[model samples]
Target: MRYVSLGSGSKGNATLLEHQGRSLLIDCGFSRKTLLQRLELARADAGQLEAVLVTHEHGDHAKGALALCEALDIPLYCSQGTAIKMDWTEHARWRSLTGGDLTRVAGMSVAAVTVPHDAREPLQFVVEAAGLRVGVLSDLGSLTPHVIAAYQGCHGLQLEANHDPEMLRKGPYPPGLQARVAGPYGHLSNAQCAELIRRIDWPGVQYLTAGHISEKNNHPDLVGQALALAFGSTSRPVHLLAQDQVADWCEF
Candidate 1:
């Protein structure tokens, strides 16, 4: 299996997970044009995409899902709460998945795990194929036992390191925005991210990608330091996602 980040940041975020000759899009935060261009760059034809699995109704996570799914004649799989919030009932290409429900598609099995975020019924995912598992987790607040269980033993994982508390406290944003970011329903702090990684079981993971970074309150250096604390060393391979361009495929 392979995963490619179309982009990852506050501006937009999308990822393509491909396995067994089938391509599945995890999210569609980008505009149609941008996502299609990134798909081409990743060597995945947009016309051949199997489905769009939405995590939440946030614009940076799923703003483009319905349009892309409609354009490509594919299904949009998401929770009932997310569907209700989106209010896109027409055309009837929806696949409703409840929390903790497991479904198989394109030779890969996907399980939805609920997440604590400022959404109606947000969810993250774990995809398993050919004895390997990969977790896609982001836009979450505090990590819970369920999150740890869902993300454990991943062959490849994408985790969010959204910001540094110190930087955010001193950044340009107002007090309310800062409070929202630091709240339990907001993004995770650097320390929280590092600690969560240390708590998970991921010995055989080939790649660990940090994503959904704050352009203002975080830096690559901070993310590296946090990762070092998580692994207790600097020898482990890690990839940092960006908002401007698509990332190369990380295969496992």
Candidate 2:
């Protein structure tokens, strides 16, 4: 299995995960042109994409989904609530998935797990292919027991380390916005992500990628520190996906 992040941040986000000759995109936050260019860079033909999975209806995640699907003529998969929020009923190729249900598309098995977030129906995905499991988790305020269970034993993981609590508190966001971000329904803090990592079974995680960092509130060094602490004295490799540049292919 191999995965690459086209980009990750508030500006835009997209991730490509592939295995056994099948490819899937986790989000379509980039412009159509930008997405196409990144796909080419990864040596992927846009028409070969098996499916596009949406985590939520947020602009930075779902903004370009419809356009991408329309252009590529690919099927889109998302929670029923998220479909409604995206008004995907109007699109013929959109498919609705409920949390806890397993579905197959293009020979890939995908399972959605519900997460705490402000979106209509938000979910993180655990995808299986070629006897390998890859988990894509982001935009969650906190991790739940269900999340831990779903993400356990993943061979690769794209986990969000969205912000630093102190940086956010002292940063430039307004009081209300700050409250929302630090609230139980907003993004995860650096410490929260570290705690979640400690709870998960990590021996099977061959690749760990930190994503969705806040440009104003969090730095790559802060996220690296937190993860290093959680993965102390371990030889497992970690990569911080850049918000502006595409990440190199991670193959296993």
Candidate 3:
């Protein structure tokens, strides 16, 4: 199995996972043109995608899912609440999935895990194929025990390091917005992200990618420091995802 980030950050987010000649897209935050361009960067084409999975209804996550799926005549998978929030009922290609539900698509098994976010019934995912597991987690405010359990034993994992708490406190965002971001239902702080990696089943993970960064409140150096603290003395590979470009593929 192999995976690559099409883009990751506030402006948009998407990832492509390929296994056994089949490709599955996780999220479609960009327009058709932009998505196509990013796909080309990874040496893939729209015709190769068997389905698109959405994690939530946020614009940066679900914005282009329906249109792209409709245009390509591919199935769109998401929580029932996410589908309703996006008003995707009219589309015949929409496939509803509830949190904790496992389904197969594009020759891969996907398990949706519910997450706590401002959006209605948001979810993250754990995907598996050929006995290999990869977890895609982002946009959740806090980590729950369920999340930790769901993400265990991943061959690869993409976790969000959205912001630095100190920077967020003094940053440009107003107090209310800051509170929301630092709140229990908002994005994870660098410290919290570090804590999560410390508590998860880290030894089994071969590849670790940090993503969905806040350009204004977090720096790559800060994220690196946070990860370094959590992964002391370990040589497991780590990759940082960028918002503007496609990332190099990580194959296992």
Candidate 4:
């Protein structure tokens, strides 16, 4: 299996996973045009996308899901709460995904793990194909035991490192916004994200993409330091996803 991140950040987020010529899009946060351009840059074809899976209703995660699916004549899957929150009352191509249910989509087994976020019903995905697992985890403030257990044995992982707590506390965001960001339902700090990496079966992770980084409150250097701390003497290739560019493909 191989994956490419179209982008990852507060502005927008999307990931494309492919195996054996079949592809799945995790989110379509960018407009159709922008997403298509990114796909082109990555040498990927939208026509190959079998489905689009939405994590939540947040604009940065779900803004262009419907449009993309409609344009491609592909199905979309999301939690029922997410559908209601987005006001997608009815759509012929929409499929409801229940967290914890292993469903087959696009020839892959998708495990939707519920997460604690501000959205009505947020979910992160761990997709398996050809005996390999690739996990897409982000947008949660805290990592529960369930989350950790679900991500075990992943060959590829894209985990969020949203901010540096010290930077966030001293940054330009207002007090209320800061409180929300630091709250239990907001985003994970660099330390928190590293802790999750530590708690998980990191030794088995072959590809690690540290993503969903806050442009204003976090730096790639800090994320690197945190990852180094988490992995200790262990070595692995780490990719830091930027908001404006398509990341290099990671194949496992």
lDDT to native, each model: 0.87, 0.86, 0.89, 0.90
**What is the number of residue pairs that collide in model 1?**
0
Tens digits of per-residue lDDT, candidate 1, 21-125, equal 888889899887889988988888776689999999999988999889888889999888898899964449899988899999677899999989889899889
Return the lDDT, model 1, position 234: 56
Candidate 2: which stretches are off by over 4 Å? Answer: none
| lDDT for each residue of candidate 2 in 68-143, tens digit (9 for 90 to 100) | 8888888998888888888887688798888997988667788988999889989888888878988888888877
What residue runs in model 3 are displaced by over 4 Å at the alpha carbon? none
Q: Indicate the TM-score of model 4.
A: 0.97
CA deviation > 4 Å runs, candidate 1: 232-234
Per-model C-alpha RMSD: 1.2, 1.2, 1.1, 1.1
Using lDDT as the measure, the top candidate is: 4
For residue 115, give model 1's deviation from the true position in Å: 0.6
Candidate 1 local accuracy as lDDT? 0.87
Kindly provide the TM-score of model 1 when superposed on the true structure, using C-alpha atoms. Answer: 0.96
Predicted candidate 4 versus true structure: per-residue lDDT over 167-225, tens digit per residue:
99899999999988878889999888888888885566788898999988999999988
Off by over 4 Å in 4: 232-234
